[model samples]
Target: MLCSCGSRPDRTGARRLVTPLDERIAALLLAEHAFAPATPGFVGVTVELPAALTGRHQLRHGFLSPRSPGTAALSGPPSPGLEAGIARMADDLDAATSLVGEVTPGGVRVALEAGLEGGGPLGLTRRWALAATLAPVLAAAFANSPSPEGWRSTRQARHRGLPVLRAVSDPRRAWAAYVLEQPGRGGPGLAGLARHVDALRPPVAARGHLEIDVADRQPRDGWRVVVAVTAVLLDDPRAAAAVEEITAPLAAEPALWERAARDALSDPVLAAAARACFVEAYGTLARHGARRDLRDQVAEFTERYVMRGRCPADDVLDAGAGFRPVPR
Candidate 1:
């Protein structure tokens, strides 16, 4: 049995014993704080907390830094639902899937069903597009898995340079043409939204939610940074413009995503662009009364990487990394 005690009963009063595979994997992930599978698999969790502004730097470094305090999201197990979802999805899939950090089955990256406050659909879509534009730099900043299945430099090497899927350049056209035109599957209204998810490579908008898919699993801190930066960009268009200018040269590069995955901050262009984005985001956060600690953490990330010219991947590689084993 996956869970030895099976003491925790569900709402119906039935014990939920996980699959043996999941039980062992979860143990390693929980105890060792690191576990990688030879095949396509993930250890993930879904938080049910109400959405709020997160301090990404604190979250990332807290898990890594012994001195800093960690966030609730960073210190926990894959929820029962999330763990079961991974097992169910991995079983259902016939082909190798992408999206390593996802808990959704079949690697279908779906956001929790919730709408952004105060923003209409069109405005939300624009922010999603802007988020896609900045992903390459973020990818470089938070590159964690340098090796996936014996591949060097990136866990996502196979999927690199595949163009960020900006689903809708014009929000109106997207709603009418792409979204409405998409055929439905599960049910009514938006049951068919999944068809449009990967219509672009990374998918910009899905069922009215912004889908920002960059960075791999394990470090929620990197994910937090990406989300925070996206929110800041939405509020301050000036920061968005600065990010555009910094990344302009790299956007023109054909192998932009590949370069980010492989070279990370070591590449001069990506390092410079990442620095520019961090600076703009940091300034915007300060102006908006973001927590002092959060701002300081962001500054620390900037100093550690942009200032010194290194990425998390560099540290992993320097320490002699290898593939993590799937628990039996």
Candidate 2:
């Protein structure tokens, strides 16, 4: 992700993302949901759901329960009592000040991706499965990233791929999307995104969000099945500023993003658009009056993509996440 964003690299964050998630999950139990107290440096799990919805699910502790394939029979249909319980759980989940996501039915259940990070408490699953799910998301994140500051050529930046993920990952599977994205108001592919449907022992049937109804309509043309989103909290001032900056460039090039995968090389108009994009990005970075050293970075990248005409580094490193097109 750092590579794609041209973020100048924050090793501290990179280390935390890789190591702590493993250490925290490795020692915790999987069957029951749990929440550990957030220490100073680590993220604090604080989740906030919209007022109208009280989503349901189990809330288990991590350190105590067996973090393996386990099952519990849930009898009876949905009730108000159950609803209240789920609400409290969601509140608790969001209590983490930093970041943590919760499952609607937070207990051990089926969702291909197996874990989420909103509403509090992170998730754990087989390492390989986790990798598979996250790989696609990272790709999407990078692809959506636009030109960063301090580059000569904006070139084929990977930061703009966030919007079109649904198109490629699950082109035909809308039901799979709905459950996977239930947290985001019932979009498709959530089940597949979750990654635990097959692993549950005495497997339980997934409900509305998880179920892929044949009757549900397919995704719209460009919207597709959104597998990745560049979720930026508007409340955080810095994040809010980023939202302003990132969106300006991304919204400027919707056509380029859509064609990056299939037509990155094939489409002539798109190639021209990509080349022009490098010029625009670097021009903007320089206009911002940043240090010359930083603006020069953007200039160099512009030449690399627009003038030199090469495949983006992001493509060779991570293609699925690749969106910004350099001259190929």
Q: Compare the candidates by TM-score and give the number of the best one.
A: 1
How accurate locally, in lDDT, is each candidate? Answer: 0.46, 0.27
lDDT of 2 by residue, 1-328 (tens): 0011123336565522222222123112211222221211111111222122222343441111223333122212221222222333334433321222322221122122222322211221111122222222222222322222211112222222423222122211322332233332211132322243233211111221121110001111111111101111111223323333333333334544434432342345444433544444445444445346545644554454434443343334344442333432
* Model 1, residue pairs in steric clash: 184-192
Q: Give residue 140's lDDT in candidate 2 (0 to 100).
A: 26
The most accurate candidate by lDDT is 1
Clashes of each: 1, 73
Candidate 1 structure quality by residue, lDDT tens digits, 1-328: 1223334578999986533323234333222211111111112322211112234323211111111232112222222222233333233221111212332211113231122322342244444455556677776776666663322235446447456535354443433343333443322112122333334334334333344445554233333344345445444556656665666555456676777777777778878877778888889888878767667767777787666767666666677764442111
Which ranges of candidate 1 are over 4 A from the true structure?
A: 1-129, 148-155, 164-205, 218-223, 324-328
- Shift in Å, residue 241, candidate 2: 15
Per-model TM-score versus the true fold: 0.52, 0.24
